[model samples]
Target: MVLYFLALVFGLHIVMVNLGIAFSTVIPILKRKGEKENNEIYLRTSKQLMNFYAATYGLAGVFGTAFTVFLLSFYPSFIGLAGHLTFIPFGIAILAIVVHFFAITAYWYSWDKWKSDTHFLIGMILLISVYLIPLGFRAISAFLNLPQGLELTPKPHLDVVAALLNPTFLPLYLKSVTAALAAGFFTISSAYMLKYGKGDKEAIKIVEKFMPLATIAFTIAIVLGIIYAETLNLFVNYKFENAFGFLIAAKAKYDFSWLFIIKLAMFALQTIAIVSYLKIRKAWRFSKYIVAAGPASLIAIFAGEMLNSFSQYPYFVAKLADKEFVSSIPQPIRDYLAERLNLELSNPLATSMGLYTLTLVFLVPLLISAVIFLYILLFGKERSEALD
Candidate 1:
């Protein structure tokens, strides 16, 4: 039950951040294109995306904090150890987020007040800052998967460079970039599709522009994801085997393979929906395919995230073999952790109370915010009344 809630919050955070990063990547380029070409439609699209990003940013921060709190609450020892070793990466992510927030504010508020070039510069700053966040966060994820730079002897120590540049990190980061692009473009396409359905002829142009980009990104994401899985296989073979069965003549044990298979199925469905939309975009009778494409892409992304985490189940940091995995963590530190760490639920009462409180505090607000964002994206006027 707790794991479900954790997954829920984490999924929400991932979606929010992914979409935000996607917008960050394209918004500046769109703005520049608009300026150079003097196209009102491109400028309007950029502004709309900026508004969408602003709408989701709050929800992203909330979900991220909730995820952190859940980790601290449910898995204190793991969180503590990870933080102690990878605090620099955490610091980097936090600083990047702060800078990103300020840059976005400056960009949004100074829209027409500032010169076009100056505004574009701020947008670029926003893009760089947003990208840095995942760079820092993914380092910890890479370390969790492979613990590449840690000297877990008398006390745990981290080699910041090695940890940041772990083999797993680059693949995962690239996958994220591709996924973000796919999600962002598809989302924008979907939103404009809604507008096009509402008889806004100009909106079809946006859909036409974004759909191809979305499809290309989605294809790249799938390839990058396969590469990422191969990278994981090098370190955590069991999890990989459970996921893909791609190891030397070994079949995937049906542990978490089913989840991955379902994710793939979702991916296939999204591809079909996208292809169908591309083929019959002018046919009103087949409009449902266009509508299905967005949710299909989102579900596939969520399923991939679910498969990634759940496949590594029954272990905080997955390993190949006990003896092999423990080689990096010296006996003293192992003994210390063994003595102090209680991996199981230590206080059910506290856990229950925490869950209840967080559901009320975080979950309610998240739902409300999501509804507001959807409304703004789908139906709100050009000038958002909520923002103005």
Candidate 2:
């Protein structure tokens, strides 16, 4: 369950960041183009896109806050050391939500007011905030987990700001930003194909130009991520290898072989996707394959992150009496509980409510149906033609 939740959280985080960056970049680029007709069309489409982006960011922020609060509830001890840093990220998230709201409002009112530059400035400010807030939140989270931190329990050793300013942090931040940009590129490509397809020559041209940029961004992000991970010594002292080694303990059953395999597969798929995107003009029909590959690659990456997060479950709250918290509990007590109740003490991180578990499940589907019906009623056959 922890693995699943981590995977979901990681996937949503990547998607949200990508959407924010893609819309922010694409809107401005479209505006800057000298083609008046194309620009006008893009402006109208961008308003809708911006609304979607804002909703996505808002959802991500809400989920992030819930997840953080959940973590706080489970591991009350970490509150003293990590809670403040957690709130730091939450604060950024709030700022992002507020900025997005203002931006969307300004956009709605600016259609007739474009002559005044104030609306444009407001839009640009919102875009900047969208990019910066998420980046700041991610940076703060990464900083808090660095090795040079004050031990949460009793010892105060390292300076918080200094820890945040570490050499490794900046590289990681850059890598994260680039990854988000790459995700954004893929998203933009998908949107262009879905909306414009073969009919819109200008849109095709724009997408064609953007594809290479996305590819370049993704490549650089991967390279930088590798370097940053190495710099952090993520594999130092055999931390990964030992925990996931072939030589498992006597009672332990599953190894991390599946995780390694999944990671390798993800890497191979991303490589193929990149190659396919580069040759898109030659194999235009195969563009959908490349598009599909993008999301698949993200899923694979999410799986790998889940494995890493799960492996560190025992150490979720570090510097406690137990090097590994699960192992520290008395064996007989564990055994008796397991035997009598068929329950074993697992990682607290293993708490996730599946999508179907939500309370307004029926209402959600009903609402969606009603919205579709209303759209059909209002637009008649024109909606179908437009969609096609």
Candidate 3:
């Protein structure tokens, strides 16, 4: 249950953070197109995307903090050890986030106040900064799967350059960025589809414009995902082996392969839905399919992330030695920690029922309410105006 709660927080953080990434990725292009063509819809969408990113930024911070706290409380040893090994990447991500926030603020506030090109440059800065975030964090994630940069024995040490250049890092980063693009465009398409249902003819145009982009991005994500999985297979093949065995739950043991299939299915559905909507040109009859795209993309993203995490069960780091992947943590140390800390060495407060109850009752509701508030602000009849 505790691990599930932690996963929930991490998942929320991933969604919100990716939303920011997706918005940042598209906003500048939209702004530039709007400027070049003098299209009101494009400009309006760029502004609206900025607004959505701003709204989710706070929620992302909240979830990120909650995730960090959960890690600190429950997985102190893991945090302590992992933090030491991956501090460089973490620092890079943190720095990028700070710069990204500032760039977003400047881009949002100086919209018409600055020259068109000047303002677009600010948006570009925002885009670059935002993208750099995933670059650093994904390296850390890849490192966990293949701890290539660090020596585990004779006093642990990390080679920063080697860590950043891990085998799985590039594909994972590309997959995440492309997923962000798909999710962002699909989400925008869904929003416009809703307005189109409410008799806004203009909204359909917006949907038409974004749906194709979403499909393209999703296609790239799918390809990159395959590349990522093959890279992971180089380290861990068990995740791909017997991938569909979960369908026969009665006879099969649990495995993370089901997640991979579900993610692919969702992605396929989203792509087909987008293509069909583009071909049909009837937003009303296909409203369900159009709106479902957003949630489908999100589900696919979540499943992909969880598959990566769950596939490495029972160990935090997998170091390659003599052409085989094995736990980076030595067996003797694991045994000592288990014996001394009762098999919960990674989670010091594993038995803290009171703290768990407090978090579930208080912290969880607060986070949920914040999300509700954001939904109201973003989708309500009275939408928030751009800061400028």
Candidate 4:
């Protein structure tokens, strides 16, 4: 129950933070190009989207807090070890977020400050920092999963570079960055589609570019994921004798191969669909297909996360505290944490409870988003021209 709750919060955090980061990220890119091309459309759209970026950034902080609370409360021992082991990356990430917050704030308000390049530079810095932020997290998460980082002791010492560069760090970082980019660009396209409908040319262009880009990004993610899976397989094969035959996990007791297959099919179909749509972009049905890109990519993202989660099974990170066959220490470690941190929820989600909880969790956001959409529609608070 606790893990499920945390997963929900973290997933929402992922979506929201990715939205904010991607929107702000595209701003500088578009602004740089807009200035170069003398294009008003790019500059105007970037400014308009900044409004929503501010909102997403604020909401993400809320979910981020929830995620931290759940992590500390539910998985104290694991996170305790994690915090000590990857302290440097985690520390840097905090500083980065602080700077990122201030940078985005400055960029938002100084749009007409007669320092266009400087403002864009601020956004570029924010963009780079936002990109690095996830890498820090993935470093810790990957370490936790693979137990690949320096094993902490009563008196632990971390080698900053080595800790930040855990065995699973690069693959996980690339995979997540690709995922964020896909989500990020699609989000931009999504905002336009929902606001202006598919007929808007700028919206159409964004939709078109993001579609193929998402397909490419997702494809790269798949490749990186495959490499990560092979690494996991090697560990399993060594520990459990040919589970993946050194190519897949030999721990086949519960297989999510089907989920992986479905995810692959979705991406392949998305690519094919986007390519077909682009080729005959004038077709009357083009709008619908372009619109479909957003949902397909989102579903792909969900599927990938689900498959990864199930594949790891009992461990938050595989083998960290796993107590199956030859693994049995995770539960004991949790017990060591005392009452507040020690929680054992045996899939406490009854079917009815599951349905009810999921409905409420999803509906609240849907309603809030609907209200925001309507507010933007009514206000028509469009962008002003560049500072002259």
Model 2 lDDT, full chain set: 0.53
Worst 10-residue lDDT window for candidate 2 reads 337-346
Taken over the whole model, the C-alpha lDDT of each candidate is 0.76, 0.53, 0.75, 0.62
Estimate the lDDT of model 1: 0.76
TM-score of each: 0.89, 0.69, 0.88, 0.77
In model 4, which regions exceed 4 Å deviation?
152-154, 190-198, 236-251, 256-262, 281-285, 321-388
Instruction: Find the 10 residues in a row with the least total lDDT in model 1.
Output: 338-347
Off by over 4 Å in 1: 245-254, 277-287, 320-322, 337-349, 353-369, 380-388
- Model 4 agreement with the true structure over 1-388: per-residue lDDT tens digits: 5656666667667767666656767778887787888888777777766756765576678768877866665556656766656678788778789888998888887876858779878988878888878867777666545555443344554666665666666876787777767766655555555544635555565555455666676567678877776665555323222123223544465566676666767677566655765675564234444455566666666666666555555555555334452243345544442232223432223225665477468747854874575365434463222211
Which has the better lDDT: candidate 1, or candidate 3?
Answer: 1
lDDT per residue for candidate 2 within 203-311, as digits (tens), equals 5654575677778887897798767656544422123442244633312222454664676676576667677776766645436655565565566545544554443
How much is the lDDT of residue 269 in candidate 1? 70
- lDDT order, best first, reads 1, 3, 4, 2
lDDT of 1 at 102: 96
Model 2: residues with Cα > 4 Å off, grouped in runs: 6-10, 34-45, 84-97, 108-116, 147-158, 195-202, 234-264, 282-286, 304-308, 317-388
- Model 4 RMSD vs true structure: 5.6
